[model samples]
Target chain A: MISKSVAQFVRSLHQKKYRQQEGCFLVEGAKSVQEVLSSTFEVDLLLTTDAFYKENADGADRQRCRIETATAEELTRVGTLESNNAALAVVRMRANVPLLRAPDAWVLVLDDIRDPGNLGTILRIADWYGIDTILCSETTADVYNPKVISASKGSFTRVNWWYGDLTGVLNQANAPVYGAFLDGDDVHQSPFNAAGGYIVMGNEANGIGPNITPFVTQRITIPRYGDAESLNVGIATAVILDNLRRVQG
Target chain B: MISKSVAQFVRSLHQKKYRQQEGCFLVEGAKSVQEVLSSTFEVDLLLTTDAFYKENADGADRQRCRIETATAEELTRVGTLESNNAALAVVRMRANVPLLRAPDAWVLVLDDIRDPGNLGTILRIADWYGIDTILCSETTADVYNPKVISASKGSFTRVNWWYGDLTGVLNQANAPVYGAFLDGDDVHQSPFNAAGGYIVMGNEANGIGPNITPFVTQRITIPRYGDAESLNVGIATAVILDNLRRVQG
Candidate 1:
């Protein structure tokens, strides 16, 4: 049984300001909660159904976090998901540490990508392409947003992200910076960096910001065959990464 | 000024049953309303701001639909979009007629794409790849769903779709049927049909339904380099279409 205060605390994390004040965010549903239990991130508290608790008690105990058994209805009421039958974890956020680019490995950079769903999907796409590190401009959606966490499908645990001023990082870049643009070298024909580099994606409505555009060493376009105005940024990312992997292989 | 009855009628189209019973769907936002006005699809009614009505009065006149000048707030109140400042169109639903495959052009088949947003994004992707025809399973989300219309941008105007039994269509397919699967020929290395054929995408959670699996002449897989359990249906669709276009070229 969950106390009134604990339930309210969990509910409060739904808002960004509360999450920031608490330095914790929610990971809902069975799969994501299970994933967070195994990851290195600290879980402050976990509220779960009896069945979930029984199946995952060992993992939950290892996290050294307080665990409370609650009804599925109770779990759903406190969580962001429509119907979370299994679990929800209030996990602590990681520090805004700088991530170094690994040798011969691609790094994804986000410039003011404001949508939470898009950000989360991009994280999952990055995980699919084995791009582990991501750099985000401060204007990008908060990594700790529950929508982002849910959409990532637990990929948030595997991928590392750093949010800061993108211009400073791009200006001092030692490797090539590739940006997605409407009029640029065709991604299918353009040769990518053999040693890997920074791949920057911009805002949903606007392309890359003016501050970062000058730092791009290469501009790439996904050729359009039909009359659609533009591709969804997450879809564009996946296509670009798929092509990148194909050429690298 | 919009009347109360008209507002009630527009709001009712948000549900599928109402849309079917009335044989009309809502097209919200400035761009989509404009596109639907210009498309062959008939517009039954149009609610627009005075500013929008002035800008596109000729096109609105050409649609031969009843035009009501309403405030942006009124449009927003009755529409699915949070802020529809320009226009909202009540469009007549097209007949569920069969679409013939254009020779040497690919056709997309969806088994049970349940998410309205995913369905809309797929339509956009199909438009981007020049795949104009789509066949949908009965269980698929209704194409006229407001979320689908909004997510599709304006691609819903360009792409043609038919909803019916997958079994009948696949049994009579004249060309190769390519189904996306987990274990199959690597899409990158696989030789595609020189002449375009049917490319089938399945349900979001379930890859391909058993009913449609047997009809697939060739099973294709997008090779995953990292740890994502599966790609989102829309992302998968884009990736597959991109590869198909690249190889065909």
Candidate 2:
């Protein structure tokens, strides 16, 4: 059973301020919890239902991560998920943002991606396409937002994110800076060299902001052939990334 | 100004059962409202703030839909959206399911897409790729759900959907069925004939259900290069469609 103080401490992590202040954020569900355990992230606390640990005994033993028991009701209180997932954890948030100068490959630079799910999906897309860095403008939703953490399916561990001025970072990106827009060049037929660069995705309602738009070297778009006015930002990101990766003479 | 009874009526549409019972659904924001008004879907009412109407008079005129003026406060009370978008409309649900024939053009068959955003993205994807017909399983999220409607960004008008037994519909799609799965053939190298067949997407947690699994004639997946476990379903759909469209050679 979770004590009142423990529950209070866990719930506080829901806020961006609280998560930053403590240098810890929460991840829930068996998949994410297990991924964190196996990855480089340090687990502050490991809370799981007894039934969950028993079923995956071998994986649990190899993890050697801390184990704490919770009844079904206790699991219900701590988990940020809509339903009571099998496990939840308080993992230390990486404190520093790595510099963007050394880009061996692509990094995603998001300009105010407000939706947590979209931001997370972008991170996952970056992971799938071998892009290892994510630089978020201050206006972007907090990376540690639980919904993003869950949507990423633990790709957050592999990708490094820095929250700062997008203009400053674009200046640092020596290679081409590509932006997704309505009238941009067709991504399907565009020439995207794979040396290294930043792929900028913009706000859901608005495309890339005027502040960073000037720095963009290539304006590209996933061409729409049907009647929908716009594709969801996440889908557009994947379409663009997938196409960019497959570009070959 | 909305009367007490009118406010109560508007608020009720927030629920799926209520939207179903009244045979009407809500659309918000300038673009979505305009799209619904312009489409064959009937508009029961259009609610807006005064400022919105003045600024968007041209769009409103083009739509020529009915109108109602309300304070922003009144909109919040009746709206399902968290954002205070300029307009909202109650559109008559087009319960008309298009004829269930094997589409000669590409069609997306969703076995059990649960996320409103994913379903909406899929709807938008269908629009981007010109796949107009989407057949949903009974378990999929209602396309009329405000999130799904909002996420489609007005693509809902172009895409026709039917919620029924998925396999039955797949039976009609005798040409070919491409199912997305982890163990499927690499979509990059696969020959996905565009001779009007079905491309099936699975549930978020579980892929195609057992009932629908057997109906898939070909299983194809977007090959992943990173440690990320999988791609988001909507992203998978876009990637697959984009590749298939490219691999048409």
Top candidate when judged by lDDT against the true structure: 1
DockQ for the candidates, in order: 0.83, 0.62
Q: Indicate the residue-level lDDT of B238 in model 1.
A: 96
By summed lDDT, the worst window of 10 consecutive residues in model 2 chain B runs over B95-104
Q: What are the per-residue Cα lDDT tens digits for candidate 1 across B1-249?
A: 899999999999999999999999999998998888999999999999999999999889999999999999999999999898999999999999988888898999999999999999999999999889999999999999999999999999999999999899989989999998988888888458998899999998887899999999999999888988889999999999999998786
Flag clash pairs in model 2: B104-B196
lDDT of 1 by residue, A44-129 (tens): 99998999999999889999999899999999988889999999999999989999898898999999999999999999999998
lDDT of each: 0.93, 0.81
Top-TM-score structure, candidate number: 1
| Model 1 spans > 4 angstroms off | none
- Can you write out model 2's per-residue Cα lDDT over B1-249, one digit (the tens) per residue? 877877788888889999899999888877787677677777877888888888777766665676789887788778877765578888888775654545467878898899998898889888888788888988999999999998888999888898887776777666888888888888767558767578889999898889988888888878777778888788898898888766552
Interface RMSD for each of the candidates: 0.8, 2.4
Using DockQ, give the best candidate's number.
1
